[model samples]
Target: MSAENELLLIMERISDLTATDAEIAQFNAWCDGFKAQEIQVENFDAVSERVLLQVHRRINKKPNVFLPLYMKLGAAVAVAVFIFSVWFFSSRVKSIEEIRYAADIAPGRTGATLTLGSGKKVNIGLATAGDLAMESGVKISKNASGDIIYTIMPDNKVTADAVNTLETSRGQQTQVQLPDGSRIFLNAASSLTYPASFANKKERRISLSGEGYFEIAKDKAHPFIVDTRGQELKVLGTHFNINAYSTEAVSKTTLLEGSIVVSTATSQQILTPGTELINNGSSLQVKQVDTELAIAWKNNLFLFDNEELGTIMRQVERWYDVEVIFVDGISKERFGGGVSRFDSVSKLLKSLQATGKVQFQIKGRKIYVTK
Candidate 1:
């Protein structure tokens, strides 16, 4: 494409918030070419200043012939963040119209609620980092690292029958160490219910909703069973991730280490490392997959590998604690990239906007997607 067309295309990509990886790569090339042509614009600051001057000059010369409002707005943002490309772009300024419907919601953090067996709720997010509670002969404490630990006393001969639940709301996450030394990292909008002390239980069984990553302590005699949605994962000792969000199309169980037997009402399969068992309705399928991408949320990163725009937005909706509403319907375009979960939703949305396939309008905490 010609230089003018290429610039317009980049601006268009920025406006629509649907820029593809290849398009972003091409934009970076253009930025390099611009730098080579004008050596004075050596760094991001210089590029931002030059782009700002150029944008103002264009507006001054042909103020009546500006691009569409959205395009102009997007282009302005793209120009501002051109130096950083896909990974980091936070210098963009919001237009007056865009600001009217802007959302400033922060990303999810380490926060959750602990429900004692007595139905009392303790907001762990607000609780101090010390002894949280003692429930059912199990000593529950919050360590300095904000991790919940359950320690059972040796001398106390009380096998109490009580179950405790840990839940994380939208824009929050929490980790808990079970009595058996197993660790569970609960994701936002997820919950895990288990017995306070597993001493009397036949098996280490836990029920999960939403999503969580598990690292089961090795105990071949007492198998660890996870009940999620309509599927059950049976393993002796393993590390895996389960994504059973109600809004998700399917329930997925990805294994990272050890072995697991994933079963449903209709089918069963054995999964090894680097494998995932997907449950769609009553059907089950197993396939080799990338475990890192599956557990990206636990690592504080949003990793999307060829995921549909609608699918990508669903994750964004949960992490940013926002609502997503498609203007006509969901955008079918797919996205592939990774961004820090701690960044503003605008930065993430701006990266998507560069794809040149879809557009986004944030009104309060709701995101409207359109083509």
Candidate 2:
């Protein structure tokens, strides 16, 4: 293909956010070539850089370059492109937000640790797709999609009430299918402990810490019970999310479908879909909430709706496994935004910085926050 046509295709890929790292590097090289040829852009606006594409109408020779420039979405920046002798060009920049780089940290992925009834820990990420173990008349294995699965063996008597635990550390998350056919998604820095077989149990009981999204299998005969730090949630086949991280003083239970009874030491409350029960370690209050936001972490998203900076950073600390040190005089303003949880820590921090309420600097495994 011709050089000009190739440049157009590259620009399209960039606009669509489909360009590879090498392609981006190539584009940058083209820009350097233009500089070598003594061509310069006349205008570059600092604040609303309304794109002014001024390609020099005259040149000493045909510069072997397809110039490149960056445009941050929601921010204005001028861009120019050049190839061969053709000087006139118009390009549309969209979607690709230029993230500030300070030694880029990679995003998190799916991984977890499973502790068997025998107290042996297995790294699910390194385990092969097969029967990981056998205990309590249930077979523990990992599926092709890397999710843990538990299956009951027919005609096999229930052995000891062997309890197993699945845990995910920071920069990790995982899903598991319980022997009762329920599905639970454990968020980063979370763990779930349950019996290997629910065959003889009156209630399919499980203990949870940190955060989890439960999709309980429909079993009206046996209700499911989740024991957390500050609340006990009982339900008969429903979907819900519980956030009871130890670092936070408040715990929440958000129901997505069906109903759940949340019980504290003194009070008991029922939560319907689209509502959340917040336990402030002193009182329990049920309020209507956006269910999506409550389970946003399970959906691989970080959605903050009028959430405090400290509250938001707490989440960042868990998901990225970073220590947050704050200097004095940081704004107490609440901010709102949505960012992909699977992205690097910088992207999330940059989005928060865009609010003009905070700044971040990464040093080793620590994130320093400033006013």
250-273 per-residue lDDT for model 2 (tens digits): 898999999999998999999889
Q: What is the C-alpha lDDT of each candidate?
A: 0.78, 0.75
How far does residue 252 in candidate 2 sit from its true spot (Å)? Answer: 0.4
Model 2 TM-score?
0.73
* All-Cα superposition RMSD per candidate: 9.4, 11.6
lDDT of 1 by residue, 1-371 (tens): 54544555664554444445455566556656654544223343444544444444443443323323323455445443444432222112223224523665678888899999988899988999998887777789998878999999776764658889899998999999998999999998999999998886779999999999999999988999999999888999999999999999999999999999988888889999999989987798889998999999999999989999887888888888999999879867888888899998877877787676766678788887777
In candidate 1, stretches whose alpha carbon ends up further than 4 angstroms from where it belongs are: 1-102
Error of 1 at 88 (Å): 29
Best by lDDT: 1
The 10-residue segment with the lowest total lDDT in model 2: 86-95
TM-score of each: 0.75, 0.73
User: Which residue ranges in model 2 land beyond 4 Å of their true spot?
Assistant: 1-100
Candidate 1: lDDT of 68? 34
Model 2, residue 199: displacement in angstroms?
Answer: 0.9
